[model samples]
Target: MSSFTYHSLPGFGEQCCEEYGFSDACIIGDRIIVTGQTGMNPITLQTSADIGEQVAQAFENINNLIVHALGKEGHPAHHEGKSGWEHVVKLHAYFVGLSSIRDQARALMVRSIKQWCPNHQPLFTMVGIESLPFPEHHVELEVFVQARMVRFVTNESAS
Candidate 1:
């Protein structure tokens, strides 16, 4: 049959599911392909002007997606060994005015990645963009993760 299975976490990417019919992430076999995440708060829908804040929020958003995809709670520090961000294998970050904030974004991203994936380094890509879906958003991050093990919920009702 088909390997693709799509999901949208409760508050994170539900709008896209309800309005646009796009899921936050898709699971194909052991891999989770997540949509690009912005700094905009899912509850407030507001994005911070500070690039650091935006970058931090974006990473948090990505982590939340990964956590939900793995069918686990969002807390407790870490999941069963090699879960959450630890499963991430690739990351692509899009930044507006990358030249202006390259150093700051680099430092922040590097620190976060090192903290999250201390044992392995995921392939990373950073590119410049003129604008994002929202004006206030300064950076967007998308991740590709390989789950060491996953319990797939075949239907939304089951999830």
Candidate 2:
């Protein structure tokens, strides 16, 4: 068996975690993997219809969660000219309506990166889907990052 301690994020209740059958974020050893986060506000649990806002929120969520998990909230120092964003191993950007708004979506994502984590590079895969589980959500971001033990990310839901 693997040797690692586990805990759920603090903001949301245990009921929500159990109902969803997943934690907002989990850490094991030197790695902490967080679930995808969307622009949707937890209070309303409603996703924004605006593509730009959605993209921005996605980037924000990833950035915030990673830092929180590192026990260093806010902007942390970069290591070897590498910021938290650079450590992201994989990014899966899922688009609900691609054929019609592919260009717009791409632009939004690029702009969000510039705004959130400037001059950063990470492997990304863009997937075009007819629709997402949440009908109103236009975009979703799944992030995988390598992190050392410190803190836990507080995320209520993706959107």
Candidate 3:
């Protein structure tokens, strides 16, 4: 069996899971898989009560997770690594109260995609969830990126 490595950021608290559970970031060879991210306030470590804010924060958290994962492999953060929408062969977005704010959630996701992956577009699926693991969580996003080794490059180096 191929062994996978998991990494975590300092001062980010404990991994969401224990035992068979891994950290927020995981690496399988050159590919990095980031777990779902939520719109939680960094300071208090609490989910945002507002849906829009939660949506925005979730993307930011995803960005941070990507950056951190890359950094673990000796790459710089925000590096246009081999992962983006095009590289992201699969994406899953879960929204709490999705029926109530489906339009707003989509808009926020579009905004985040524009900001994070402006060059590539990935296949995505959005689902309305009755509730998340956490009551405060209004939105959560999980993404899977698949790319070749050559395409991975730091954001600065890409320019």
Candidate 4:
């Protein structure tokens, strides 16, 4: 059986299931799966009004979760210095006021992706919805990535 690990992000508590019925991230074998992440402040645990800021934070949180999971398994934190697998194979960006701020949100998201995944590029879809699952949330992002596992070794270490 492959070993699977669960990681609850710093800002998100262990009670994710009780509240959201989902874990922040889950590892199955060498692959890691991350759920939808929003732009909520870690300290206050509240969503922000600025879409750009929120989008940036959401990416950061996803990266942190991926790193933490890989570290637990003795693997490198990033795949080619990018988070959420390889090039975010698939992405769904949801905005509360998508109609009004679609362009702005897309601009911010592209910038954030460039900052996070400089090498890998993934297919992305943007959607504007009337409301998100959470009322306070203005934007949410769902990403799917596939990355090859990397092992670290020292010159003196045995194969």
Clashing residue pairs in all predictions, respectively, total 0, 1, 4, 0
> Which pairs of residues clash in candidate 4, taking residues 3 or more apart in a chain or in different chains?
none
Which of the two candidates, 3 or 4, achieves a greater TM-score against the reference?
4
- Tens-digit lDDT track for model 3 on 1-159? 545777654434243545335577677765678777778854468775778788777776766666666666765323655333434555678987778888888888788777767666667799988987778887778887553424558998899
CA lDDT, every prediction? 0.81, 0.63, 0.68, 0.70
lDDT of 4 by residue, 36-86 (tens): 788876557877777778888788777676776666666653534545534
State the weakest 10-residue window (summed lDDT) of model 1.
72-81
Q: Model 2 reaches what TM-score against the true structure?
A: 0.71
Question: After TM-score superposition, what is the CA distance of residue 80 in candidate 2 from its true location, in Å?
Answer: 12
Q: TM-score: which candidate is best?
A: 1
Model 1, 62-125: lDDT tens per residue? 8877888767423233356444788888999999989888898889889888877887788999
Cα-based RMSD of candidate 1: 9.0
Q: Pick the candidate with the highest lDDT.
A: 1
Candidate 3: clashing pairs of residues: 79-154, 79-155, 80-155, 82-152
How does residue 101 of candidate 1 score in lDDT?
Answer: 82
Ranking by TM-score: 1, 4, 3, 2
Q: Residue 119 CA error for candidate 1 (Å)?
A: 2.0
